[model samples]
Target: MNLESLLLNNLHRFPPRVVAWIEKRLKAIPSIRQKIDKEYDDMMGGLESSLKPYKDRFPAFTELPAQGRDRAEILREMEAMQSQEEDRWREGMVSGAVYHGDQAHIDFLNRVYALHSQSNPLHADVWPSATKFEAEIVRMTANMLGGGADVVGTVSSGGTESILLAMKTYRDWGRAKGIRKPEMILPVTA
Candidate 1:
């Protein structure tokens, strides 16, 4: 049998403690560890190509140029890059992307972003406008979801950060309740 099938069969038969011990032993072997690392690197390399198609085509800078690039040149470059990347989504060739992106909606959002570009919600004392916007967004979402007036919400950067914050909250709540260890339930398909 292949090593993977053997490991799978053994894992099914072993208890948690025994499985952990086996895992430790397997990782302790230099060849096995090196093989795992190499496999991970190879997998990431394959993913990187699809993730960053422009990495090879565009000019990359490690440091700022002595003289700043012209504003018109920068705008032209941005437009070129945007056109190249937007076609797939615009034509509905990409999955789970915007259904449509009209010039009016795009222009309005761009203007709004530009107007508030300098505002930092993190520094709420200095940028109360940003904080107010965040609060209103949370309130609207809570209301739309049938949440009561007392319901509170906060914004997160993204899904992974939101999950991490929830996990941390669970850990703390469990500790407060005298539970030494807490378990997080994750979907197998997630």
Candidate 2:
């Protein structure tokens, strides 16, 4: 029921100006605040119901003590889900995120993923395989540029963070060099 937290949680998915206007309008109208609360409750209830289609199929959490599910049983359930859901993505029916839809390519990636499933580059000593994979990925990317050998960078989720990070880095660099007003010009083209 915390409005501020809810707004901030949803900020990335919404326009900043729209969020600001909604916040302002909600604060201005007492009735709107109550309406927003009711809407949020309705939305949460609908989402919860939609998520748990097998609510009655599985034992209720309240009825059973918290315990780990058997590993084989868990894997069986996950494999069942993957079998049920793989067709849609495999045929490229979805809009985004799915890359290879062909069964052969999917199986190839699946096998590669399974091979490196236990590898975690976070601990290079424990998983040198992961470290090597990451190193080669970066190395190949760097090789594409004219300055092939010296290039170094990390992969990120998308352009938003990359732009933000670049801006912050430039800001810091400018400040360090005693620039009074550090401003980067943005392109006006849509």
Best by lDDT: 1
Clashing pairs in 2: none
**Model 1: per-residue Cα lDDT over 9-45, one tens digit each:** 7786878999999889998999989988999999999
**Pairs of colliding residues, candidate 1:** none
> lDDT at 46 for candidate 2?
96
Estimated TM-score for each candidate: 0.72, 0.57
lDDT of 2 by residue, 92-180 (tens): 77775576567788899989989988877689899887777777877887887655677776655566787888788788888899997
Tell me how candidate 1 scores on lDDT.
0.85
After superposition, the stretches of candidate 2 with alpha carbons farther than 4 Å from their true spots are 1-28, 49-68, 91-93, 145-147, 155-190
* RMSD in angstroms between candidate 1 and the native structure over all alpha carbons: 3.5
Worst 10 residues of 1 by lDDT: 91-100
Q: Which of the numbered candidates is closest to the native, going by highest TM-score?
A: 1
Alpha-carbon deviation at 9 in model 1, angstroms: 5.3
